[model samples]
Target: MNSTRMRITTIAKKELVEFVRDWRTIVAILVIPVLMFPLLFILFPLLLEAEAQELDELIVDVELQADDLPDGFQSALEYSSINLTFAELDAVENLTEPGTAMEKLRSGEVDAVVRVRANNSTWQYAVLHMSTSEQSNEARSRVLLNLGEWEQNETRNRLVAVDLDPDATLNPLQWNGSIAQGDVASKGEQAGLALSLFIPLVLAVWTFSSAIQPSIDMTAGERERGTLEALLGLPCTRAELLFGKWLAVATITAAGVLLQIAGLTFAIGYLATSDIISAPTMTLGVVALLCVAVLLFAITVVAFELALAMRAHSVKEAGSVLGPAVLLILFPALFTQVINLDGIELFWFAIPVVNVLLALRELLLNRVVPVHVLVWMVSSAVYATLAALYAARQFNREDIVTTLS
Candidate 1:
């Protein structure tokens, strides 16, 4: 037992020294993700807000018969600061036809067109059009306000004509909607899902990239350089070597995951506090779940990467083999987002990366995951352990190592 511990400690120290000495590798592991999340989550929303403010200005084209417009209608349009441009009713004879008006609106020549019917009644119709898809919302708001004023005037005229009281009760109805299932997830849940969907992908990338290069270089790269044989002849047992290498990979991957989490937490907190997003506060419980999930995810990825690395002749070859595994880790997490399985099912918990993402999402939303979530976590850990053991067995084989060298 002491010998095994000493061997593992020796290998772990060597791995740490190699990792720290490579400045480029260290930067790749730490800097990129730390910078990306803040830029994506924080600055992107600010840009959108600026664009929305710019979109609020709209121009309206009015073509009303001189007598058809009510007394206060034009004044109302002016009061709303709708940039009203007028064209003679005949000047737009066929040019201002419905289709032409629509084309003009789509082309940005006008924000909206108001056409007063030849009948001098107060029942004239207005159609507002916007060039840009985003500008349509602002156009709709202005159109609705103008339409409401017109409706009110028409209602008063009818009341006066019928000699009826304005306050007489019309169709009286009351309606309400309620859900009795467990406390319905608020908009906060949706926001949480949105914030967390990329977390799994981020973790996968960090784990694979941070561990893959070093893991391959530690094993396959040493083999290519003829240094692995010397180390193998040392009195180190296979389990000790594997444990030490695994520990090193886990350390780097875990550090990467921690850095990613730090970046993500800062970005998310900024967004929530700034009112850009309506996510709930991440409690200690949720943070604990996230930490566990990230740890397991890192171990699984590092194990898989080392297994592939052990099979390759060189670091480049190992990278090629492990590239797909990196993409595969993203799948289970991505699948969680695309699949909306019922929360009560135990089957989903048995799945690997998917289970972790689902559990974390539930935690963030303050949902109590079933006890089976722990069972699934244990199962995933078993799977990762078995993979590491299998890789260690491969490392113990003389023929496989010789062929790679």
Candidate 2:
């Protein structure tokens, strides 16, 4: 037993050395994670905010016949972000044709055309003809906001004239939404809600992507380089060889995931300091639980990757198989995030990948049922064991080791 343990440890150390030396593996395990999460989660938001501000600088041209507008409506439109102009003297005839306003919208001649007609003593019918272009949408939004304010002011004036309380008249229904904990969510809860949907999927994808090269290179890559025979001829058993390779893969994959988490945390802190976003609620306890979950997930992924790599005779062949496999795993992980977590059926915990994602979702939401943790850990361990055994059995075969087939 001591000799076997020593053999596995020796192999694992050697694999780790090789992993650290490979530039691609080093980048995947270190540099990419440090850059990717921050760029995606932090820089993207800043760029998007800048783009939105730029969109606000656009000047929209809108045509309106002010003569027929209500007393305060034209003034309200003038105060809006849009530039309102009087339609041509023959505008009525032109507007009657099909697609006339739409054609103008397409040609960028105008952003919107507004027509208003008194429908009743208390109501006015307004038609806003606009394209789906960004400028037109912004124009429409501005017009709507101004109209709503005008309507409120008009309602208040009418209420005052009738000697009635404007607030009472406008809002008879005192309905408001409140969370069970309070009227507003605490900062931690708010952060959890924002991140719960996305973080699990990101972690799962990173775990798979980070492990792919290491797992394949340890098996098929070595085979393609004609080094597998020498390694297999060592006195260690096939199970020890498989376990060591898998351990190296899992270590690299888990490190990649943790590095990404660090990046995400740093980005959150930077954004929060810049007042661009709130800090995420991943407390030390929460992070510890997350790391445990990620460890289990990485183990399963490593074993699965090793199994596929063992089947393939070359690095390219392993990649062809594992790429689709990663996609297959990603779809299910993402699917459970949008599903009703509160009402998740017990059977979901019995499944392999589904349970891990669901468990992550619950954890991010700051709750974890004991049964869920038990089921997730137990089932993942079983799958990892089975997969590892399958890969070891494949390694024990002379044909798989000796042939390109």
Candidate 3:
């Protein structure tokens, strides 16, 4: 066993040397994960907030079309942030034309058009703006922002003119709204919902992509470069050679996963609430679960990819087979998001990639079921070991010398 380990270690190191020599591998495994989380979590939100502020202060040109304007209608319009320009109805090309007002709004001639028609004591209003246009949406928001205040103020004026009590009428049945409190989850836990859905989606692609070039380069690529023949000449058993190469791939993939987790820790720390950290118990457990699930999944993915790579006649063939395989994970990952965890069946835990993703989401949400985790790990271990063994067996075949398959 010691001799086997030694041979494996030696082979693994040799493969790692190639990784270290390649700058792209270093960047993919190290730098990208470090930089990605902050840009996604921190920088993007700040940009959105800045844009929202700009929109709030924007001066929108609004065209108002109201029939028989009320006594204090202009005064109520004053409460709105929109710059009420009051463009004429005849300014339109045709009164009978369908969507004439909408056409002007869509063409950017007007930011928004407000139509107010009074019937009995009710005033029905519609704000017309192009949904595709940001400025138009902003203009519509500005008009609607103080709608309640406008109604109250106009009602007060009308009531006073008719010598009636507006307050009594408005306060006839005032009710208050309060959120129902149950099953309080920490902000970290709440954040986990989004984290699980989106994080796994991105990580799946990253993990697969990170493993691909290296796995292919070590397999079919080595065959292309005539290195496989030389490597095959070594006395080390096929299992030892496979172990070494797999360890090298696993090391890079594991490093990328660890760095991503660390980056996630730091980036999520920015959004931290509830005692400068999440619940200590939950956080640590979730982290442990994530490591186990993801590492096993990575092991399985890399093993299968390496096996497929060895079977391919060339690097291009391997890529064609592997690239679109992401859809297999993508479809299930998307499906799991809408699925209620409470109703999930135990059989799901036996599935390979899907099991890890679901278990990952549960962990992130701080919902750790021991049975689920155990099943996922055990099943994943089985798949990963089988995949690795299959890859090693490919090396033992007589046809492995050249791309005969």
Q: Which candidate has the top score in TM-score?
A: 2
Misplaced by over 4 Å in model 2 are 1-3, 88-99, 120-132, 175-181, 271-287
Clashes of 2: 0
User: What ranking emerges by TM-score with the best candidate at the front?
Assistant: 2, 3, 1
Worst 10 residues of 3 by lDDT: 273-282
Q: State the displacement of the C-alpha of residue 77, model 2, in Å, after optimal TM-score superposition.
A: 1.2
Candidate ranking (lDDT, best to worst): 2, 3, 1
Instruction: Tell me the tens digit of each residue's lDDT in model 3 across 296-356.
Output: 8888888888888888778888888777876777787777677678868988989867788
Clashes of each: 0, 0, 0
**lDDT over C-alpha atoms for residue 275 of model 1:** 69
Error of 3 at 357 (Å): 1.6
Q: What is the lDDT, from 0 to 100, of the residue 119 in candidate 2?
A: 42
**TM-score of every model versus the real structure:** 0.73, 0.87, 0.86
* Best model number under lDDT: 2
What are the per-residue Cα lDDT tens digits for candidate 1 across 4-43? 8888988988998889898898888867668767888888
Off by over 4 Å in 3: 79-81, 90-103, 152-183, 273-286
Q: Alpha-carbon error at 122 in model 2, in Å?
A: 5.3
